[model samples]
Structure formats: C-alpha cells, structure tokens
Target: MNYAPENSESAAAAVSAIRQMIETGKLPADGRLPTERELAAELGCGRRTVRRVLDTLEAEGLIWRKQGKGTFAGQPPDPTGALAAEIAPDADPLVVMEARVCIEPALAELCALRATGEDVQRLRKLAQRASHPMDADTAELWDGALHRAIARIAGNRVMLTAFALLDEVRMGADWQEQRHRARTPETMALYETQHRKIVDAIERRDGAAAFDAMRAHLEALSDNLRTSIRTLDE
Candidate 1:
C-alpha cells in the first residue's frame, strides 16, 4: 500500500506499486482508482509523480481515464467508444431506445439468473443512487451505471460491447440535454418506480419478471422521450 521513492525514481516506484496492485488483483479489472491526490498520499509520492505514473500506465494500456470519470484499472472499455462518438450526431434517441428495448430485457433476465449476491448488492446501491440523484447530470450518471451494471452482470461479452456502444452514444452532450429537457417530476417518479421493480425482480431471481420489468421501463422511457420531443417541435 506504500512505496518509498528514490530521488529520480519516484515515478518508477509509483508505477511499480500500481503494477503490483494490478497483478495482485488488488485493483480488479474495470475498477476505478483513487484520485491523484489520494494516490499520492497512499503511495507516499507527490501528485506530479502520481500523474506521471498514471500517464505511463495509460500509454502502456494498463489503465485508462475519462475526463470527469476517474481512472479505471483495466484495459479501456469497448473500443467502439470512439466510433460511438463519431456516429452520435446521427444516432437517433428513439432508435437507440428501440435497440435498448430489444437488448436490455435479455440482459435483465440473464442478470436475474446469474448474478451473485455481491452483484445484487451493488445493483441495489446503484438503484438507490439513481433514484435519489440530486440533479439531472447525477441522475444520468447513476441511471446509466445501474443499467450498465445489469449488462455486466449478465456476463455476455458480445451483448456488453453492443450495450457499451449505445451507452457511449447516449453520453453525447446533445442527447443528455434532450433527456434533461424531457424530465418532469412525474416522469422521474415513474422512472424510480420502474427501477425499483426491475431491481426487485432481479433480486428475487425471477428471470421472467426481470425481463418484463426491464422491457416495461424502456418502453416507458421511449414513450416519455417521444412525447417530450413532439412537444418541443410543436
């Protein structure tokens, strides 16, 4: 947990410590790391040294970072993230919803059947974070996390890649703005209820119920989004 740095080898020491953590599974794949400040403190090094170490690790494909999201301890997420960004401008939200309606229910069903106790626990925590989001941005973040958790727990690499692509597109600024605009108090409540239903079904290990709940939730989202867009056009 602590590393002593020689004069010019502080960055090297930090790198070794992080690499050790990764190798030992102390930092699991797709796991987020502590902030630069936190890492500096924990590693007994300067923030600059930590930064350099992170830069090295990132270039070596041992870790990756998103601007606002913290660094993660794995190879990057789906390579399609870049491609998603390129096509985001042309990706219709309704079309994306159609895809979700097709894919997410299956993920939910699989999650219900396959999720471990820890997975269900994490899902509950994510659901709670989403239901109590303080602002639109927070809501979007936790809500997306909740859905992604389900996909990950489903344990299908191919489906997860497809879902990740859609996730990246949905993270587009324009799409987020539209989603925010579409929000209303009643709609938020409905979403919260829907989220609860889906998580509950998964917790009970009822695949059919989980599938039905997820499909219902996505359908509701599609209906609300469509109505919001129509109102804006009018």
Candidate 2:
C-alpha cells in the first residue's frame, strides 16, 4: 500500500507497475483487468491518474482498453501457460502411462546391468524414504524420486532429465494431487505392494524380472486411468 516507488523506479511508476504485473503473470493476457476505480484504490492513485496511466499504456501499445470490458495485456506473457489455463479433462493419462511403460522398464533393465553400489544404495534409499512407516501419503514424494533414481541408475543423462519435464507437467497439471483424490486405502495398499515388488526385483539383480515388474506397474496404472476416465465419462 506504500505508493512510494523505490528510488530505483523511474518517474512513470504506474506504467512500470502495469508492465510488471503483466510480466509476472498477475494479469494474464486476454484476461480482463479490474475497473479503473478498483485499480486506483489498489495502486493508491487517483482515478484521473489511473486514466492518464491507461492512456500512456495505450499509446505505448502495452495494453488495449475495451471501454466497459476493461484492459487486456497486449502480449501474452507465456505461451506455455505455466501460471494460467485449466487442466483439460481430456488430457490423456494414458500418454503418461505409455511413456512410463516405454521408458521405465528399459530403465530398470539398464539399472540391473549398470548398477554400482552407489546406484543400488541410492535407489534403496529413495524407496525406503518414500515407504517410511509413518504415512503412505508421504510415500508419494519418494515415489517420484524412485523413478528418477531408476533413470539415474540407467546412466543416461538424457533419460534422467525426462524426470524434470515430467515434474513440470505434473506441476502445471497438478497430477499427483488429482490422482490422490481417486485413491482408496485398498488402492494405496495395492500400489505400495507393487512398488516394493519392483524394487525387490531390481535389488535381486533379476534384469528380466525387474523389467517385467516395471511394465506390470505401468499396465496397472494405465488400467486405473482407463477406469477413472470411464467414470468421468459416466
């Protein structure tokens, strides 16, 4: 509420404020802004000052006002929509499962071939931490880490880095939170048992067995996605 711009801010702070709002994604492009009066109140400026600022913004091509409809950001900040956009209901969980099916079983096979003491130890640590006895929900963090650990054990930097992309997708779409909503105690127990089985196979250095176990995990996950989608369709 301190309308005083720091000395670093140039004389035309209002216009700068508007640009900052757009840049930081507080005001999404194609989204309407508040009324001039409301903006004035928030900015601690007079309505006339707000009008002057709006005129300057229009002149600079930073924004366009539609009279009664308010203003819109001239340039869409992020085409990727990291901070905006809805999760489309039809976005396929199958695609994620498909990637896991293709990527993870091979990852396990490589781990079986390439695992050093450090690699196996890291995988075991991740699995243990995720499956810590306190709460199963806490296991979900380790769940993601376990996959990344497997990829790391594969010794492929490119494959390991896919975890970052998947993490970004999960954040943007809120994947784990959404999936958690669909889970029951029976389901949680089922997944925990399956996860431990895969880890055990990897620890046993059974490459083919580990691969099969990993594939089965993805198959089950895909089935769950299918069932969930059917319920949604219903």
Candidate 3:
C-alpha cells in the first residue's frame, strides 16, 4: 500500500491503487477494504488523505461505507445497460419526485400486505435511524433506505427494479444538490414524523393506511422541493 508523496499526487496514487485492487479481482464485489487507520499506515499517508480518497470513491459509486462496517467495493458499472442510460446525469428532480409519488405508495400498500415480522423489525430500526439522523445527509440517506426497504418488502421485482433505478437517479449530483437545499432541520423533523406514520401503518398490516401514509409523506416532500426550488430561483 506504499504510495507516492504526501501531496495530491499521493491521493491520486491511493485512489488508483484502491481502484486497481477492485478492478483486478483483488477486492471482490461487496468485499470489505481495510480500515482507514490500516490503510493510512500501510500507504504511509495520514488518515485525512485516506478519508479524502474514500470520499471520492464513494461519491463515484466505486465503493460504499457503512457507519461502523468498513468500506466495500461497489458493484461494477453497467454503462451499456438500459438502466444507466435511463437515469441521465441531468434528469429532472421533479420527474424523479413524480415517479416516486406514483410508485412508492403502491409499494407501501404491497409491503403492508406482504411484509414478514423481520421486515417490520428492520423498518422500525430504519425509522429510528431516520428520527435521529446526525445531519442533513444522514437524514436523506436513512429516509431513502426506509422507502427502499418498504419497496423491497413489497416483493415485486419489477417495482423493486424501478425503485432501485429511481434511487440511482437520486444519486445524481443535481438531485443531491436539490435535496440538500430542501432538507432543513424543520423538514427533517416533519419527515421523521411522517416516516413513523408510514411504518406504523405497515406494522398494523393496514394496506390502505400504509398507502395513504406514504402518499402523504411523498406529497409533503414534493411541496418542500418546490419551495426549495423557488427559493433557489429567487
């Protein structure tokens, strides 16, 4: 893991080394990488430099880091695939929101009907995480996870694939910027409450209630986004 210098050159070298390891089958898909401290020591660099490299890799979807779990190699890109082409870099945030409003409520209804006890438990845990998010970014991440979990519990591969694609679209820089603009502390608190309502409805096995709760949550989010866009325009 020995790298070049302690400058930008070193950071680039670190990224290249890690990328090569992943590409060369040295790091299998979803395989955990060494911890930041270990990487820093091995590469003869500071933790800050390692962190910057990790951040860059994560942002590029080359890797993902869990809060406590170490970073893992991301799934390889499918550049030639329809999904990659569908979610364009400049896709409209409003279009993404509209798609969510249409699809997620139905998914929640299905989840309420189909979810197992384990699914309910996991949903509860995700809701708790969203309730106590550390910052705007963490709040958004948990919020997306909660919705995605509900979609997964619905047990429809088609809907799940659509949801996953929508998620990929959401990871775009434009969408992230728009979401960051909209995610105020007050809005996060409101979303936490809404998330609880949706989870509670699902736990009760009330499909209708779950559908309504999810629809309400997304509608509120859409409103917030509109307000944020207007403010930004102003």
Question: What do the candidate models score in CA lDDT, each in turn?
Answer: 0.88, 0.69, 0.85
Model 3 lDDT at residue 90: 50
Q: Which regions of candidate 3 fall more than 4 Å away from where they truly are? A: 1-82
Q: Report how far off residue 31 is in candidate 1 (Å).
A: 30
Model 1 lDDT per residue over 1-234, tens place:
334443657777889998887777876456888899888888888887888889989999988998898998877766697789787887798988898999999999999999998999999999899888899989988999999999999999999998898887877636776789888889889999999999999999999999999999999999999998898889
Which pairs clash inside model 2?
none
Using TM-score as the yardstick, the better of models 2 and 3 is 3
Candidate 3: lDDT of 120?
96
RMSD of 3: 11.7
lDDT-sorted candidate list, best first: 1, 3, 2
Model 2 residue 53 CA deviation (Å) reads: 35
TM-score of 1: 0.67
**Better-scoring candidate (TM-score), 1 or 2:** 1
- Tell me the deviation in Å of residue 55 in model 3: 31
Residue 100 in model 1: shift from native, Å?
1.1
TM-score of the candidate numbered 2?
Answer: 0.56
Q: What is the lDDT of residue 60 in candidate 1?
A: 92
lDDT of 3 by residue, 88-182 (tens): 65567887889899999999999999999899999999999988978778877887789889999999998888887787777753567778889
Top-lDDT structure, candidate number: 1
